[model samples]
Target: MNESAPQADMAEQLAASSFNTASRAIVIGGSMAGLLAAKVLSGHYEEVVIIERDEFQERPANRPGVPQDHHPHRLQDLGKGILEALFPGWREDLLAQGAYEREGKEMHLISPLAALQFPYEKDEGCSRPLLEWVIRRRVAAEPRIQVLQGHVAVSLLTKKAGSKLAVSGVEVRKQRSGGSRDLEAALVVDASGRYTRLPEWLEELGFGKPVAEILHTRLAYSTRYYRIPDSLKDRYSTVLIEGDPSLAEGSGVFSPIEGGVAETTIYGAGGHYPPVDPERYERAAAKLIHPMLAEIIAQLEPVGNPRGFRVSECRLNQYGEMPEWPSGLLAIGDSVCNFDPIYGQGISVAAAEAMEMGKALRKAAKENGPIREHELQRRFGRIILPAWWTIVVADLRWPGVTYEGSLSGRGIRFCQEYLDIVRRQALQGGDMELFGLLMGVQGLDAPPSSLFGEEAVRMVVSRSKQDAWLEKQLEAGETLGDFLERSFPVFHPASHSEANR
Candidate 1:
């Protein structure tokens, strides 16, 4: 009799545990950010729901949610690593789906300062849609997550928590019928990207608009798909010809995608625009410092007419600085900070944000007992700020982009001098490691500190033999700042009034 009673007690305990494991979480948007967020949420929430506006296709293809999918997007080493961590073998899945290596094509980098071949990481190079779809399948397979497509999140449902408001659920509307419904959850995340309506939602909740720092990229990009020539495949090459700021052209990229197809995107800043017409695009590529892209275009057959995307500015929303920051809702990815698309930082940054959120939640659950919304907000804000700083610093170099000047003039000169040294070193001696390190920093695989290390400094100092031309500028009574301003005039901030005029 005592044995039977003990067995019954164990059964009751099991039932209780099962009941407690059903908590819910909701993530808005089903893009990379949202998928990554849902993957993280699955660890903490018993069930996670993803709300996506676009319908998913069986194979990877461009969707409406991501307007720039038509253009080439590479998963940086950091982003690829993060995806691998989230989905143990996502890289393999992508490769199996025709994702090729960065080395699939011969590559060349033509900079104003030097001409070199950029070394892309081995496990990278996939179309934007293919990468997203691969991750989507993994997220969908998670036992605790559910994908709901063709529904858009209209507003966040919040409840009064003491003097502050907390998000409790989301109100989503069907894309076709406009039918609406509310789904409750313990937490809500916005990863809706550049087209997010989170700003309006916050205003409706009585929070004055958040402060914003805008960097006017004045950038327009056009891409056309191409079928690689069989002769070129044995030696298919990708070329990056950076725009000459003095000439008003921004940048041109010819990348080989997985399917023996290449994407040529000519981009520009200021008033110079990427050509949308095929013949004009050829003219634009011909004007680049290098003739590789133009030559390649001649050999390849065009897949479709070139498509163009223009982004007026890159905006950083200071949501954390809001007078009354609300709990229950937080944003990640392009929703919080949309970088200029040329950098290829969006996917990586989104992955980083999602991973950080997961770590914070798990840590809070173990050590802090329960998550404090304000503290969570503060921590999240801090986690993303460094990466944001890195991205903005690079973007600010363009005259059309804006920044508040945390990076000083002297610092700019130091960077200019350092880059000049590295480029010179790479060109003179073909110091692959030096170029690789700079590329790594750009890929978010390493911090800028990596470039200033003793080895790097020594290599540049030894190989560069000192830049005589730059030294001459300094010798001619030019300040460090003045030298940089004169040499790379693009970095100097533009006058809005003059720009307008």
Candidate 2:
């Protein structure tokens, strides 16, 4: 059973019942971030217009505008909560539209130390198209908001306000009509993604370009769709093999999607590429840390040819650092900070930023004052700092990812060593809490600070010793039990205190 977007004019209802201090707002992207932003802006502005370049279909499908739509996407529990907050009942609405539910101990995670099955936690996974389609439809239901498709934004119309420049409107050219128009707006938001033309738009208006930090990992991935085999249909919903660069050069993922189809993605970084050819793509899964994915996919029938995608780098634009950053102009989503995509943090981070924007707008809503442009952009910029730091820290471990002066030498070493321990400890038995915390942080549910608690620090310190001993055993061709016996001969599994550090 699929849930449909509400046809009721809730936007009209809000316009009639409440007073609005702002006249119009324009969101420059129809992406997940833009849709969520419009949902928030609708409450404060009398009319919110979302400009998009693609003509959307009535059904769920991919568009040429979003190049990464072919990949498997997820709304981890943390992001799901944010979506539910913005659009009450979003989970239910999404589930009704053929999205699969992921819960319990359904993941088969492989690492360098040992094969691990994650403790059960609820989540949702779907194709990127379906997620975008549902969100777009919901954005259309608001009478105060309008989705303008087949129009490309050409330039930002700016005005010199005394000593400062402010964004006044946007100049857009219609793709269908070949006509151009100016859309005047008090607030202009750019969520146009990684390929955004904000750099050109800003420079033409005589503003300094924001500094950006980019790390090139050279990650390439090939994804193919499949029909789930009846044998594994009822057993588990996902199997992910985390790429262990030490043992293997690539990773593999097999998860259920809508329409009873499964999507398998094989990826590699550091100049490695998974095959896009059907025969070789199937063979690509065999190089994972485990052969479970290869065996599973062998029994299923693939629905389409494997398609290849690349994420050459992770970029974070420094907009707030500019003293002369224009007022009435702000950007969110990938346009501000785009991750490597393997972490699956992009969608969740966008949702979190939308919430921040809403929080900033509430001040204007209360005072009946015009929306504060510079303050809102700066606030949103500060809000994403924590996640931005977390992303930089993680990608530093990969080869060819240049972050030379950004992170201190000593700090980088400590994070690398600590994360190595976290991965090793996650593979050990009776350490579900340690693994869960790591997953939560990766899922954007828990803050990176959560991993630095007294208990966690103690655990890492203790595991550091264990990891050193385990390394020796591997060099000497000894087993995990051998290392345990040689190191902790007096203690067994019952000695939880030793493992707890």
Candidate 3:
């Protein structure tokens, strides 16, 4: 029997409590966002159930829903800290399972002019499945949380009382046995990722879908894994070969994983992407920035054929501006907004969203009796918009990438000059303080406006001029190989011809 709605008086009493002791939270989809949502809901609700469409994985492994799990994934330092704050010792658990920490250390950053090899610091690098598994384990272990695997949520069950449209539960379909059932809850969270059908469901309920702002970049990621040498095992954690706009091609990054294995992924926007063919992949990667990456690829034995993913669209649902939202429902993570994966901001932003959602839920539980579903969704949307703009605006600079918004006269000039300064700073490498600031905003730690300060502008301008001059000299003189051989003793200390001397 389906659970009936709490009476008005009973709901009022439940609202006065410190937490929603009499209510339940039903989380749709059981990926990272779903699991994190479960954790947050578990603290406030009497029961938290996660409904997953895929079969249960008793061990740490991949699921059918997350196809990008096979590709390379990097968890930014911001995400690591956020995850730790949410679930303490989470990093330690991942590291124990052979996850690599590649930030600040073992990272080879190559610009058009120089190659920066920094020692590893603290960060998280693992397969998406492994990372998800760690979080899932923690969430699943919670006594108040339940994982209902092989249960596909077909539709949200709602109860209309006068003007209030509140979700009471969900109707689910069993994958294997073809059984159907209805699970009732006080609230529902949609963390069902980019391919979510929530909008259609809302439309079916006579609610106009939220306006979507789509920046269709036709972006694609091609990934392949290889066995690294023991000597190079400790050499560099990640090698980033940035793309040049002049070439109109792409960039490649090779991240070292556990057990002497490394994953290299090439990303291209539009149809100008790296080939899946092994030889062609090497050639295209060599042209990007670092020839050494291609050399490494040539030397290593490939683990398997390269897997490809096309992200043709990035959409931001403007739910914050909605006039009316249903009660007892919210959308978090990729279901709300999807960013370009090349920037590597997806996981970081998703984690930030989860943190925001948790804070909002806690605050609402304390003050309000029964939190209206729209309020939580709006707050979460408000927090994510600035970060979305930051990513979309910056990424729109690449040729062939599309943008829906407008930037008038001064705005256009300012943006052009701004990127020029950023490029220069990125190459010269002295603006760690500024980079830290920009990265913080990029990672959603700070507001987007924080980057537009006068001090930042000045620093970028002065550094950009210096970098530009250096670039001119390098371009006029020789390739990175010849220049390094002639000037730097460390990189090309002994040349081929001079070695005999």
Candidate 4:
């Protein structure tokens, strides 16, 4: 099969159909998620309007809205596939606009135990601004989509539909003029991002607030851009040094971006924040588990001063759990859930959500049925669950991290320990398939349960008796079966056997 075949098929499916679900759809926010949502909405609506607080420029540049644009950002392979389908030739467009093509052979992952070279396919390397710019250009070219810049959505305009309030439109305000106006629409999607006011708006509209699940890791990172030396250009394009959870230190990335420059971000979880001072930043980089990043930093010429960003918590607003949801309204992207940037799951998850939304809209248009807001929200929740859990489990490894949600501390520890063994096995045993499975689940391309497959369980059980960490747990009177039963009741070995039978 041709590699481009899937993209062609997806592009054909995304093309506007003769049947229309609504006259107009309004998307709140004009970032990556909002833009993708608008692109999806364009297929099923006559007109799609994106309301953004930041004004767009012809060239790619950082804006105030995306404060973390200065740092390194990655578009996961799954997300790249989705975007290629959404806008054909987007990867080439990015390269034409100065993005770098990083092949899998150029990617390196340095763990506490070992350094692994992943021979994956080629992926684009660019800053967040350029990625957003390329996608914005694609959305701008779409005839049915209109981006309303310098405008912010103030609140939802709703009307009574039986017992529940149905969103009719949004009250938007001009950021410069401070003037407000109402724009009517058949559908309103909130992609207003991590600091969304949808929960407050819902409460004001009498629907009550959704439960907010938060995992606090207090992660902080400082980034500095450097011109890549000519001698090192042929070296590894990306190097990710994993942090030691016990020490809450030694995490950093060296990524080559566009404009012949590379961005290095040194980060720490728990309370150990990377400093913004140039001297201290170097010190932090030197202290990392690997010296590659620091050595490269010393060799490259600095392009800019160090900039810092902090993420105190990862939040998920459980809008699906609401007793009643307003019709003609939906939320996507960071409005639904936002993860720590280190995982690089945000853009990919948002793209997946938009793709799913497109599929649902197509189905609703074909059936001439009303869109089920609550059901759709629940489906989006399912899409976000694995990514959220990945971040939660990973973050819990660091000292001083705390999670307030469904999973208990013991369960989190079990997951961390299990994954630790799996990771060690994958790296030390040279099990590429197992490594890929672990990465696929983290990348949101595979379900989390894939990690609990028969092969994985066998490895875990067999390795546990010999592994020092697992031996400690076993000596503490907890068997592997007991750990599985306590940590994952629904996925106990007995249940696994029963299901297989």
Q: What is the C-alpha local distance difference test score of each model? A: 0.71, 0.71, 0.69, 0.79
Which 10-residue window in model 3 sums to the lowest lDDT? Answer: 491-500
Task: Note the residue pairs that clash in candidate 3.
Answer: 15-369, 105-119, 105-120, 105-121, 106-119, 106-120, 106-237
Sliding window of 10 residues with minimal summed lDDT for model 1: 492-501
What ranking of all candidate models by lDDT puts the best one first? 4, 2, 1, 3
Compared with the true structure, what per-residue lDDT tens digits does model 3 show for residues 86-204? 78999888889887766566677776756666666677667788888888878867888766666678898899857778777787776665656666778888988999988888888
Better of 3 and 4 by lDDT: 4
| TM-score, model 4 to reference | 0.89
Which of 1 and 3 is ahead in TM-score? 3
229: Cα error in model 2, Å: 4.1
Q: Model 3: number of clashes?
A: 7
Q: TM-score for all predictions?
A: 0.82, 0.85, 0.83, 0.89
State residue 112's C-alpha deviation in candidate 2, in Å.
Answer: 1.5
Q: How close is candidate 2 to the true structure, as a TM-score?
A: 0.85
Tell me the tens digit of each residue's lDDT in model 1 across 304-336.
Answer: 888999888777777777777676777888898
Clashes of 2: 2
Cα lDDT for residue 262, model 3? 85
Error of 1 at 409 (Å): 6.4
Cα lDDT tens digits for candidate 2, 35-98: 9888888887888877788867889888988888888876655567777777777666668987
Candidate 1 global CA lDDT score: 0.71
Off by over 4 Å in 3: 1-22, 101-104, 405-413, 462-501
